[model samples]
Target: MTHAELHADAFATLSAWTPPSHGQFSLREAYLGFLAARPDATARSCAPGHLTASAVVMSADRRSVLLTLHPRVGRWLQLGGHCEDGDSSLAAAAFREATEESGIDGLVMDPAPLDLDVHPITCSLGIPTRHFDVRFLVTAPPGAVAVISDESDDLRFWPVDALPPGTDASVTTLVAAAVARG
Candidate 1:
């Protein structure tokens, strides 16, 4: 499927379900609002119980970012997942997701969150529907090889200027902003 199709499908999956446990209450509420406001849009809010965090893992050279092709969502996404109970902070949760999904060890990530975004999911039913996605900026050593995990069907690096066709626009904006700041 095309990238847009993949994104739409993923959003559909999220919208059909309620937020996860790790999601913040305010974010969850906002997500529901989005779903109600834009039913025609392909995204829905994640339920409170299904909230999760993610990280935008970048190579040390700062030329590329690590992304995973999630099997369920079937979209190219940054490395991230649900925040388990033991995570001390959002950044930690993002870190865990990054490592687990990408299998790139020894990564160094900022202690704080880099950006916050909210997107609606369209997949789950009887759920509040949305993910208040919190993303972090993480760096790996130059030339690090990414090992894809079960969560993702593939793992690879894409150039900052020329990303894969299916990447989220928000991700590109964030990456560009970071590059500008540096």
Candidate 2:
């Protein structure tokens, strides 16, 4: 699909959910606000009821991106988790998640959001949990090795076009955008 088509699809996927974790409005509301401000465009906004941050970390040379195999999700994904109260900003939260999940310290966190993806995750009770994911594009030093954390069973760097099987489509779109921006 084309870039615009990919983003439209991603937005549609996020807008279709009515996650219970969001006590107030649905993600569609937040996405609508973002859409209105940049009508005929897509931009970033704080998703309603989303409390997590994530990062798609790339090598300094821009050859590969770091990915982790989530234990529960069983899919290759960017590093992220629920935001803790201690985090001062979403960018900080994404930076923290990248470091913790990849064990790669001294990475530089970008100020602007790389992408915004809101989706529902079903909990053990089969109730829909929601996350308004704020994704950043972080840059790691060359030749950096990633150590897997407990949250992930495996960690690896893969070329942008050669992502692992069952990779999240949102992540793929974000990475493509990041690469294009460069």
Candidate 3:
């Protein structure tokens, strides 16, 4: 899809999603407002912030989650990243990130967003920016093996109840949402 199509998809996904909490509801509204103001909000060069797509990937049995040790964040977090220019939709961008990071083919993604988060960081642009992340739930096939991409310092699966120490709180929230969704 063209860049404009992906932006429209982002707006549609956030608009359709019913937040599980009031905080998320506020975030949803805030994101829609942001998108309304910035047509370039989907681009990595947006400077202020941009829409990123991420996946909380659960094992088929819901016993484990595939996480990445992000080189930048220096923490084990869910697999996801920025929406590419060629992405067809926000959901597809999320699925693409999961597939690329996990190196697992045929990963099943639920099109509806699982959660939303806005966090500040210096992304690839090498300047401080916020990631208005749109999170989704994806299921890796049973016995799926992940090959760590250059994007991560490491990659592996951890039991849902036993994530690594110092994992991001947002990651914990994502795991909870994935479990609840299952």
Candidate 4:
């Protein structure tokens, strides 16, 4: 399937899913509205917002998560980025981003999304935008080595019990969900 079709399918999957009891009540409604407002949402059409995919990457033992210090956000975050034309599905997009950013190959991803977050960002496209972030779970094999891409200031595997100081709470939640699902 094409990236657009994949996004539509993924959106449907997300729409039909029941949010975890701990999720914010408004997140689903915001994401659905973002979909309705932009037909090209999946293609980086960049109207009200754009489609972005993220992976909560875990080690084989599931005791640690790989996080990047995003240059733009200036905070530690899960590996992810905007969907690319080469991507065939949202899960693929997430996995691709994880691989590219983390420089780790042969990673395994869960097809179902772990969570969603909609937040505003200043785009290089010269627009104020929101990223409809569809998050998936990715697992790295034992002894996986990660090289930091130019997009990040640093890359590291953080203990599940001790994430970085600037790590978002939602990221911790996503990690918990991924661990639970595993």
Candidate 5:
């Protein structure tokens, strides 16, 4: 998909999504507004910020979650990254990132977004900017094994309730929601 196509998909996805909470509702509006104002909102080149696709990957048994220790942030985070030109939709981007990072195939994804988060960070552009993250739920097939990707410092499965120390609250929150609804 081209950048404009991705931007349109982002708007449609947020428009069709029914926020799971009031905060999500507000974030959804903000994302929609951003997309409306910026045709390049889906691209990483959008300096102010851009829409990112992310996933909370659940183990086959649904007891543990796969997490990546982000190399840049030095923190454990869910598997995800910027939407790519080939991505047809946000869910596809999320699934693609998860699969690429985990090296696990046959992963199932629910297209509905589970949560939204906006945070400032110096991304690939090497400048401070925010990520309007659209998080989703992805499930690994039985016996899936994760291989750490170059983008991550480490990769492993952690019990949902026993996540490693200093895990970001956003990650913890996403995992909790995924567990509750898994």
Candidate 6:
């Protein structure tokens, strides 16, 4: 499918998804607003902003989560980034990003997203933009080894109970939501 088609699919997926039990009611409205504001929300269209897909990667025992020290943000965060051209859906994009960033193969992802967030970012050339992030829950098999991608300064598994000192609250919330779902 073309990039436009893929974006349409993502919008539809978001539209059909039921809001999570703990989610804010405004999230759905914000998502819909994003869809209306940008046609390339699923691709890197960047017409004021774009959509991003992310995963909260959990270890097999469910005690650890893989976090990347983002080079740009300078903070430990979930594995995720911009949706690529060939992605068929938001879930696929999130899975692909998780796999690429974590360097772990054979990962399994939940079809339903664990959380949604809209945040501001300064992209290439210092353009202010928003990332309408759709986050999924991903699981790594026992003994899976993760390699840090060039995009990150470091990659490590953090115990869910003891996230790093500067961990983002959004990441912490996502970990809790993933744990609660399982």
lDDT of 3 by residue, 11-129 (tens): 99899899999999999999999999999999998999999999999999999999999887889999889988789999999999999899998799899999999999998999999
Q: What is the lDDT of candidate 5?
A: 0.93
| lDDT digits (tens) for residues 1-182 of candidate 1 | 33234334334534444433344345545645643454333322324324356888887878888878878678777887654545655566778888887777799987544555666664345544556676678888777899877777888988889888877777786676445434
What TM-score does each of the candidates earn?
Answer: 0.69, 0.72, 0.98, 0.90, 0.97, 0.94
lDDT value for model 1: 0.64
Tens-digit per-residue lDDT, 55-128, candidate 2: 99998888799989888888888898765545655677789889999999789887666666777775332456
Q: How well does candidate 5 match the true structure in TM-score terms?
A: 0.97
Report the error of model 3 at residue 176, Å.
0.4
Backbone clash tally (model 5): 0
Clash number for candidate 2: 0
- lDDT by residue (53-150, candidate 6, tens digit) is 99999999999999999999999999998888788888999999999999998899898878898888986637788888889999999999999889
Which lDDT tens digits does candidate 4 get at residues 1-182? 56658668767967876777645436766777767766688877666778789999999999999999989889899999888877888888899999999999789988877888877888766788888898999999899989999989999999998999867887888888888877
How far residue 2's Cα lies from its native spot in candidate 6, in Å, is: 2.2
Model 3 lDDT, full chain set: 0.93
Scored by CA lDDT, what does every candidate get? 0.64, 0.70, 0.93, 0.84, 0.93, 0.86
* Shift in Å, residue 159, candidate 5: 0.3
Candidate 6, lDDT over the whole model:
0.86
Q: Stretches of candidate 4 above 4 Å error? A: 1-3, 22-26
What is the Cα-based TM-score of model 3? 0.98
Q: Deviation in angstroms for 107 in model 5? A: 0.6
